[model samples]
Target: MIHAATVQACLAFALLACVSVAYGKPTGQASGRNPSKAALDADQQFDKGSGIAIHKLDGAQIENLLTLGKVWGFLKYYDPTVTSGQRQWDYELFRVLPAILEAPDRASANAVLVRWIDGLGPVPRCSPCAQLDRHDLQLHPDLGWIADTRLLGKTLSRKLQRIHGQRRVGTQFYVALAPGVGYPVFKHEPSYDDIHFPDAGFQLLALFRYWNIIEYWYPDRDVIGEDWDKVLAAFIPRLALARDSATYQLQMMALIAEIHDTHANLRSSLDVRPPVGHCHLPVRLRFVQHQAVVTGIDGTPPNTSMLEVGDVIAKLDGRPPPALAREWAPYYAGSNEAVRLRDIATYMTRGPCDEVPLTVRRGDHELRLKVSRVPLPKDYLAMGDYLAIAFHDLPGPAFRLLSPEVAYLKLSAAKASKATEYIKQAAATKGLIIDARNYPSEFMVFALGSLLVDRPTLFARFTVGDLSNPGAFRWAPPLMLEPKAPHYHGRVVILVDEVTQSRAEYTAMAFRAVPGALVVGSTTAGADGSASRVTLPGGLFTIISGVGVFYPDRRPTQRVGIVPDVVVEPTMAAIRDGRDPVLEEALRLILGPTLPISSIEGMYRSQSP
Candidate 1:
């Protein structure tokens, strides 16, 4: 019954189809205003329309996931001023509430929404979440979900037949973030503005998940609604923007910033070398005007000539070294120069650097340096796993034993060789003094508790993320030590100052609750557990805080640092002469009325480089 022209058109289309098939085009690859009939059918079938698509989730899910994302961005990150729990949720609630009510079925989706709003476990919150406690919204007769609202105020038996096939994604995001893996339901509440934010990883996740609901559900509004397309449209372009290492890093930071918790942040790479040479810089640094300046250097080389003892470094590469610290700002983030300098030193070497270059200015003349760098001694390199390494060849230490009886372990945080070799050896002797007055070589903090006992123990527990999927990691106490491999339990004392930070603090804190141990020194720099890097907005980054470490009793240590039984301080003269006042005090405490100063004096006086 078809006309001749129709027949010709059909034949020509068939021929083209054969050619296209010969070229091998995959399904779902072609998508646009115009597409093959088959491709169009597939797109329509998987076309999750608006928020919850009519399409089923399958192969195209990742692409459809582009439907929403909370990528970290500098501009979108709510500032501290705007981030109070109530205000943030208020911004989201007016947008999200209606979505839940208007959901295909609110009753079926109630449990999922409530779970994400659950409060933190141990973190103190004045009140339960405000957003989830709202009562005006209709709940299913069974009081279950917001998305399954059609069942609300209706009997289950009456609705069973019609509601069976309807499926909702549920408020899965919120449920995943809330604490204790339980559903959220207000046992008692009636307030619009009473909600406060949650702490811990689960809480943060809940807050963001709550915001995402408004972002998706409330499509249009004056100040209260959200536009998924607007956010997605804005972000997808940036995601597709030409990728640069710095920009890529920035984008990741932006994603992290969206959570905006002091304890939450991005991570960077840190290289651990073989245990080799010690870090011996012939210079001293001081914090002047909130900037760390080189107050002393051994000699003025061709590139380092412009730098002096009092020179201020304006920019580290293109980033501000001190300013970027706010990103992760851990419990010990800004406690000392040692911590800050360590961050800078590692940041400079993140990428390959045959000859590391730096720019420095003394008064007016600008200068640059190409410093030679080396890895840890090759002999000490031993790989255990991607996450662990043990290096050996480190240079002469910052602290050394002056006396055999007054055993001394100088902690240098050197790569390759473990810096605590002196302490381990001294632990076998009568009295032990640890010097943390210098920088760290490597972040070998896992084995500290292992040296104290011959049985396994819980050294620390790291908690990350918000209340929901808050990740927790435990360090089972090690049962063995290197070298002698038995518990040498003896009189142990540690010395610390501002330079004792990061791994230094970690190593020092490990001694807590151990028998016959004393921390006698000034407060440590307090920058432990966190790893930092430059992230977004050109030189901006998230110094993601580490999960808080805890004692056996599950006491969290974050804002508050480890307290030493006795506090010791140092003098400039003592530093110059390489004598530790803290060590002197520890010796006094351990030696008590028995040992005489003359007995230990000769050993410390015999100096050997």
Candidate 2:
């Protein structure tokens, strides 16, 4: 016969015994010290005593944790019930990593994950949350651990339901609880090079880290032209097979290229093969009217007379221009076909030898020529001598009046502080030509844009991710530039080409928004966004477009550059004759009859001598 008092006393003793074992102290002394501090100290002691190294893991173990980590990061952001409006959620991956790495099999690894989730208290519920739509959801159905009800417990399923519900009903995939709070966003600055890959464990860590960052935060996933989930599935085996440092670096480059972004490229320390570090053919090629034409040749004595201006390159070693471009497309990072071909033309000339065989078409004659490849000059000018001849005679001032009714501002040399002064000077002019053929010296989007408008105009918008809500993107408020007093209501002409990228493209967009502003010249590089640098295993560094930029109506500007109102590409004759065709067109639109054809011809002829 058991008595109630005896049973109660026995239960109390058992509870005290459990507390002593867990806390490493007796019941009386456990209350004297801070409970949290004691618990932390005990955890550290246990970790130190354990034979397992938390930072290291085998190939199998790495793959498992990578799978679990992806799911863990996703739920932390997308599941509103899990976050409960908290600005920051504790990831604590290192705390449980040892146990996870030590697990012998998939079942055992899952057990470790279950224990980690249980430690995080009950998940709150939101009754009004909507269900998830198919298009908005991505699930790893192959991973049974994620779907196992017993492992997740009842609370996790309910929390997942709330996340799905919100996505379905409100079309909200993720929401930023606060600005700059959420996932660890990688910075795009170059801080380190030669990241030595010490071991396989460290290499795998880099792979997992990079994969998760792109999976959750990449804003242009939909425009990437491939199923991102499938890419993750395919790269698993490939990354795991990287056996050496060089191979690992190459693998990282291959993976970065999967994003299809021009900004994605290994840092300069790791030489990108096939596209760099080779002797050039000493000729500049441009895609003109869908044909590859030699626009200029190197004036070096060894390369002189081998190739001439206006020669059409029909074949390289035996392959057509288009086929050759396709062969090099994987190695040449670019956002669009135009930009890709532009870069490929430069790379096609590179080789180990100082000469390459080519089939060229010169008027009616088709002849085989061996073009000498010379080392690029140290003070190489991108514009070459022919184009430089046209600008040589222009006034040395960065901003000057082409005529009384027309003003020209060279964006590459113009100062931002002088933007207002330039605008004031050009206010009465009939036309303003803003030359952006080269990279801008400084950002002048707002400074120059404000002077061209009469009222506040929305020029651009951006898409940013919610840290707590992975894969959820929402448009930030439109960026508007208010007009400064004495706004120039004159026609604006902006010039652009391959060199006009990033800030230059952004500047063009800003100026293009001005009433009657016309963008001239050829297509731009089409890559425009804030670059974010990502460091991978083995000291490999690369970059990606961190944010999505779009027009006011949500038209994408990533792979597609800002279109020009009047397309005026320079011809081979124009380059040889030292004439500025694009500039001539801009003047035609502005000065019309005031500048006669004979006057323009004489102006170009005078620069010849």
Candidate 3:
């Protein structure tokens, strides 16, 4: 239990506030250490830990906890007193947890909940509580659980229904949309950075907090590929029984992967996840034709030829890459299978600094070789070249004329302010290749998009959270690109790959809106929309694509991504020969058969990786 004195301090402080609820404060406080210090901590916050402990739970306990989680989350988002930021909801969970945990049966649990709700005082009937307009809504409040009398007794159910009906209006203290972007800004979510490993109560709190955040605020919950409520039930025992910090983190990663979003992952550190090591094989790998193929070699002069560029890495350290990927899939969060495999391939060869055995296939010959792992290059670019795709710092200026006939612009180095200059420079060219093969340095959605069109063009639309009605989302008007002076009248081709994500994907959607613009490349990362940070207990951090991004006609772009008009994946031979097939295809489309691919002048001189 929370040190008695600390619980006393919390209750003491809560009592000083307006007493509306029936229970003056939470009845249950989890057990923890440092009584005197904890008491002082309680005067401020739950700084030490949630004192609750857990062992094995029976079927009945699981069911009871599931219902409790639903009820707690419902109250958090729906009840006016809680939603208005008047209550320390996390502490309140600690207070009520013990009573529900010890309840003998469903009725007993319901009674405990009833008292908790009653103590929050009475709900006043609002004259104009926000109501959902089905026509304009992309998602509606998921409140069917409130009427589940079989789970919540009639009295408790009635109380919940009343709270939902008169939910808080105006700006909610918990969440708000960004000033103009419309992505959710989770306010006042403390990281609880002091706790290296949280106790059972805080673990349960993490689960409850994350599950509810997605349940109510995630715009694409309908497409999460599984019943989210069931997910909550399944993970409750897993998190509660986690024996150590590593186990807890693994469970958390698995939970995050269930959301099927590339943007959602444990961002605090990569060391926690698989391929955990300080050194890696001195070669870059990319998934080509469903196989891990060497794309680029790195390090000093050696840059090793032991594994040739086109060599297919069938096995690493005697383990097949695919098998390893399968083992790590649950922890690798991604939007779709393509991007999932793309990410897995990036780190499959990373491990200890030792001679790693590898089975390689060169044409028909199968060869075995032991490659030495080296510390990543001291320079960021060299290390990036050795491992994952370069996030920024593409080789040349953002825009330049590849030739009089072809204009090249890579968004990785492009500046939005130079959009006019870029357009003017490209005006005389027959075609412009806007490379979006990496994350853009700036948001070029309107800056460059405007210079490509002759009139207003509809590109994308969005779904934003409804402040008054939590868990509900409405569609915003379609975004448009207004024409700017000196518009480029040339044909357009966009280059993209798995490295293209979020803003890059959004920029592609905007550029593709122009007439005759052709997108040529393999599937993209698929995770669009602005990312919102989610901080959990135990100092863990993650993100969710808060807003739903869609094409103008309401075609979803979350997991499906921006499908290219011309699909062109680089061939193994092309990688071995230092060629970019995707860029070649763009050149082919623009230059036609009249100009030889080799004669494109400066096109391949400073080709970007």
Candidate 4:
């Protein structure tokens, strides 16, 4: 039925297709027109036998590579069979990047991806594959690029759909489901060998890995206040153009800061240790009311007479303190501007010189002083023994009766088991004061909260990522504090400040579940949820709020922190005078001023009887 000429032409076309695939070349290319010239040149420059120099990529090349990375990471996580237990999927990404980079045009790049996808064998059907765990409530709706049908095509799309079907769900990126019986365990260790700076491949790998994680799993991405996709695009050129180790590290720090999370901070590398230079001022500074205030001085000799406590720092080396804080903010990570400025004030004392010229305001006088920068002492960073002090007067044990009818519990040193004993002791008390002004020595959310409520209460909820559906989040089961027998039916008051964070915030939430529990004081530190460490190239380490934490009603706790029912901020005068206004307010709320001495004495007598 077919002619001899037709058969010959078809055979010739088939042979050309095979040759093109083998050589990674575009089909029907003219002899002189090399579509892959720029890409090939880039590949040649980067591939120097040891590793690819990711920093050497040009703007166009970097864009292409980022696109490739996005698609590659999506498949790596969604399609488990891509690695096939032979090598790590991240390493596989590094392996295939060069081929993609060698494709000069979009069509050629897509062709390269198609070839790579083809080589991934088949998407295996795993009936017992774990369903995605969703524990945090942060959401990112912009990650549609992961499953864009135009990029993935029918075959890969159908494969993903088939995998979804195995889970009894329709094709969706983020799936909603019930909490699993157990938590999913993850290896916190690094999966790659350590490499120094200027190793562009490792740098790119770190950036891509972290970006994908945040893109797919980070719950509070929406609150980040920046276009994360644009951030990724902008950083590609910046990371690629990083000239040295210090610059690269700064770039990485800046990148981490974009999340606007206090938990997100880069651990110092050997070359990048803080106070950022060879020397630092002996004084610790705190940002208060937008002014840099000297808080404490480490016993380094030269500057004790020059700088004093309560002095306001106006300038650093002729630059305004506010401007300096702005300049240095990108180097520090915090949940909000207040925390960022606070951290900046602390770290801004360091410089390359032996002495830093400072302008400080003492009362009404502005004085310029040359403060010597000394090596920070080993114990300089320690939080002093003040937290061990019992709150207010009534203090035999951490938990005691402030008044006969009022119970005071200092959570900083109290244990979980102690909560049970304290509840029994304070059972008949009319009011309970929980001082969470410091970090807890032990977790007491259930142990303490259970004895406060008469019924099971929803304390908080978590929003976690669905790995199968990257960039999607679903609320986990509400965390409830089940009531214990002999529950204390008393009004409760909890204290909080910036010092209260993470477990403290969580504990506050649990206690806040009690009926008529009043949260007093200013906002707590906004960084809540379990921390997940991220290791980068050059042995740099960092952490982030690995989960989303929220009130049962879905009010976000991250960045926003725990808002007080009655907002109260400690005054500068109060700190200087050693006044416990927050605690005083708690006492006022519990014991009215009109209560007579006879009544108080009668209440104490009743307790003894």
Candidate 5:
């Protein structure tokens, strides 16, 4: 998953603050062995590193390690001893990794792995082992690697195959599901935060742990946009040979980004990864038609002399936006290119410098200027307020009557208790616009969506991981929204953009199921499921989309996002004119183009907050 790239100057870091957003009892608890001496030793030595060091790996060594990682991960989930929590898998990896690395050939390495599996004690034959029926499965356990005799050799391959046939089922120590929500929950993964720069063995453990989590536990792994097999092999060397703390963290960031899930990110210090700086330009930037366009400024009465709205930024600190985006893309975790660029734009103006030079295209002429930067407060409390004041532009009441015929509802501040009241008010209007461009204060999927439907309507279906089967996935029942009174008979428009993510995207899906409800805007942040925490070595944490979200008909929404029925993106001309093009388009569809754009421009400015 790691790609070597040439570093560009001032191509510093942007903190990827992805939201850290969480499952059961096993039936076969009586059959498994007690915790082993090795596990106890690992628990006692919790604060120490693996003490393994490797400066580099040749091609053959890399291949052997790749196979070892697969087998080790397979055992971690599949073998009764490891899955029963009797073996400390992380430390077990540490114990075996040095031997695997030193083995001169694949046969010798496989022998080391075989002996390692044998040491776990004989896997008691499961009386009734779990079987793959494939009747209602959305995904089957990807265990083809276990059957590759040529790669794994006859002995190791057969050993893994036998274990697969008797794989542990139910009541796993490593993973489980939430009681009500079916999303996967990882258990007992140590953060190892004490080790600032984990040694070679711990570093490899981190990669193997995360990769296997996605390989087995992630429901959306099928759509990660790459051969997941290749990713493991590619990153083995990168992580095993990580020389320092920054290098280890940056490589982990790149590894997480490969999933292309906006929910996936380095939950720890993201400042270590490049375009590294805290200072940001006074104006907010958004990519319009693939070009960085100035959309809004920070101040109440913003300064427009230096950088006006709709000005296209051709250069930032002498580097073009596209080139800069390329350099920073690997570190920016996103579901799709739209969402990726959306986050990249958020920190495009950020760097270590106090003044950022820019070349702006104003009208037909290029104007070169230097804009002063504001350093965000290091304190999270003040940073939240600063970011709100600077980057966030949604400021108004949760629900408001925009005009005699139209009503506006901003979910950013919406309360569930007022859902009926808002619907009652909007009942008299000809159209209602539900602004989902920002994260909702409350989960309004049923509270708000039910008010727009006439009957119980199926909106979404989820694919959840099976603990017994690990990598296997099966469809849960489709979620439906029951009809509620005061149902607004008026047309509905749900506004969304890249900022719309997770619960926001899920809410849009529910609202879009209404008879005449229309989604208007560009693509949204495609990460739609609840995020599960994956603790790694070096005291690091990352997340993955724990479940698969799809439409009633089984259409995917993980990375594709909620598709808009009427796509409307802000143009340079429209943005400079102080207009909301997406909202205007919704009004046109509802008001039949009778009202002028100027009349719809500031409708929310006078609304109650």
Candidate 6:
């Protein structure tokens, strides 16, 4: 039987913050740690070992997948010699990998990777395993530095590539890495199966995760504080509870948070997607000073009040993090930021019961307001982009209002919700206008291909992972030629602005493969192909990479964005009012075959993603 006292005591010591919700935080006080003497000594030992001057793990092949610099950092922290008993698997670099990393017959060496990771049954057919097989493997540019264990990790990954079938929830699947060959043994259950690095051991994973960037952060941390460890290990009782699935998702997102890089991290999947649907508020809010400040309202009762930004949060009703995590504490506590900051995220993203009551504090008075809840419009559900596709908030058309016959739809974020029904509404229209102003996810363009493809034609395709090393291969999804519904049999014009980047460029490139699609506007934000998200220790999170998109032809549309078929720019004067010269030209092209009465060199023809 689980004792409540023991559970509470262990909760204090375990430092596992399990307070989790479906989605996420703020920059308040980061959860700080003061190292005990032992932890300090361990840190010293790690530092002392660094002087040993082990060669840098440099290799083009594995760098793309493992990022050698990062892998070495993590390994040094875990320091394989350290051991964790509870862990199901461990890693040994030399015995497991020396031959492969040093091998000149690279293909033979690469083949070992497949053997290392492909273990057990009900595996190899899984999505991860299959995707691995399809990827272009880049051999290590610096083959000499490849660690046996890290190579083993590559091998383990190869093994994992074989698994088939899928679990119902979560994309960051779990795999168990056995210590001996450093192979992957488990496939299906990523959550229950804990992943560990034998060298770094499991004593302090946060350091490997948190300190890698060496940005504006340096904190003293201890895995086992004297008072806490003694109290928990001797006096506390053992506690085991079934993990909540939602909390685990929250935890996974937290892992993404640890890697602040925009391009590299975990993905649910590019093919299968998540629900873009979200519970929204009647009012628009901004995070001013750690408070959910109201900005605009769709004319709701509680939101009608003139609450401006810069107001401090006085109090929140049950919707606050404190209130939400009262039932599930660890997720809130385990988060990377101060606990208070998490409360703020909850206040923003989470739906409120009945009315969401808030107390915004100005100088002397505390204003109380209650806002009625509403669902966010589907098109507007994007993370950081303005929602479009006939959205009501904006003034008339972003492009030419009547680019006579041409209908343009440009967006940044593609969320899974009915608010997004606007796209269907767009694809069904006659003339086409696609504003690749600032693209978001690759899945949006590829996933939405069904909506655009009237016939089976190629979209865009590009190589994923590294394809240099002898062993490494490419991960290329099909260039979607199938349409979601019927082809919108109309003249299609796509507009791209300077901000057209990553997924935006990919979307533009996708249509370029089509016969009649024309790209206009200025250069795009270059960086394609990044289905990335970071994973934090505990439950912190972030994302990585600059782009997550690639053309079907396996060409790069990065640093240098996609070029427009028709080179038309927008002017400042035209932008001041409601004028899109490029869009106007597109409309002209659709309605009439002639070039515009306007000049060829214009500014942004339309404002879109």
lDDT top scorer: 5
Error of 3 at 324 (Å): 0.8
* Backbone clash pairs in model 5 (N, Cα, C under 3 Å; residues 3+ apart or in different chains), count: 11
Q: Score each candidate by Cα lDDT.
A: 0.35, 0.58, 0.76, 0.63, 0.77, 0.36
TM-score of 4: 0.76
TM-score of each candidate structure, all chains considered together: 0.41, 0.69, 0.89, 0.76, 0.91, 0.40
> Which residue pairs of candidate 4 clash?
135-462, 135-463, 135-464, 136-463, 136-464, 137-463, 138-219, 173-469
* Model 6 C-alpha lDDT per residue in residues 1-609, reported as the tens digit of each score: 223233223322211111111112111112122122232224332321111111223343232222322333332222221111111221222222444444444455555444433321233122332122333432212223334445445553333222212211112112222221111121211121132212122112222332332210111111111232122222111100113323334333333333322222223211111222244344444332334444334554654444553344456553543343344332222112222132233324335335667776654678887755555554332222211111211133333333333454555444423223544455445567666664342234444444556666655543322211111223334455455554456767877755454445566777776668788776554434432222332233333331223455545453346878787754433432435566666666666656544532222333332
Q: Please write out the lDDT profile of model 2 over residues 1-609, one tens digit for every residue.
A: 223233223322322221122222322122222123222334333221222233334666755565555655555455553434322122244556567667886667766766666666544454555432334232212223344555454544444444444532222222222222111234221122343443344444455556666775677767777766556655655565566666666666666667777655554322444544446677778766666778766665655746777887898767777777776576555677766677566556656556667899877889898777777554222322112211212335578776678888877678867888998999889999998776565667766777788987777766666442455556665676677766887899988776566666777887888887888887776767555545543434555566677887788887778888888776756655546787787788877847786666554344332
lDDT of 5 at 595: 74
Which ranges of candidate 4 are over 4 A from the true structure? Answer: 1-50, 54-57, 124-143, 146-193, 268-275, 297-306, 379-407, 423-430, 592-609
Candidate 2: list runs displaced more than 4 Å: 1-69, 72-203, 298-305, 317-319, 376-397, 424-428, 569-581, 592-609
- Give the Å error, residue 63, model 1: 30
Q: Which candidate leads the pack in TM-score?
A: 5
Candidate ranking under TM-score, highest first, comes to: 5, 3, 4, 2, 1, 6
Model 3 scores a TM of 0.89
Give lDDT for model 2.
0.58
1-609: candidate 4 lDDT, tens digit per residue: 223233223323322221222222322222222123232223323233227665366555766777776776566445555322333444556677787667676556666666676676655666565554445424643544535557555554555455343432223221122123111112222323335557666666667777876776677877888887678877876776677778778888888889988766664432253346656777767666777777666665655647877788898878888888777777777787766665576667777757788888877889999888877444322211122111222224568786767887877778876777898888888899898866666667767887888887787777766645556677766677777776888889998876676667778888998999998887776877665545555555555675678898898999998888877766655444434567666666778757654555443333332
Q: What's the true lDDT of residue 317 in model 3?
A: 90
- Regions of candidate 6 where Cα sits further than 4 Å from its true position: 1-142, 146-404, 410-430, 438-455, 462-473, 483-486, 499-503, 527-530, 536-540, 545-548, 592-609
Model 5: how far is 388 from its true place, Å?
7.6
Q: Which residue segments of model 1 deviate by more than 4 Å?
A: 1-283, 288-295, 299-400, 413-428, 437-448, 454-458, 464-485, 530-543, 570-579, 592-608
Tell me the alpha-carbon RMSD of every candidate: 20.2, 15.7, 10.0, 15.4, 7.9, 18.3
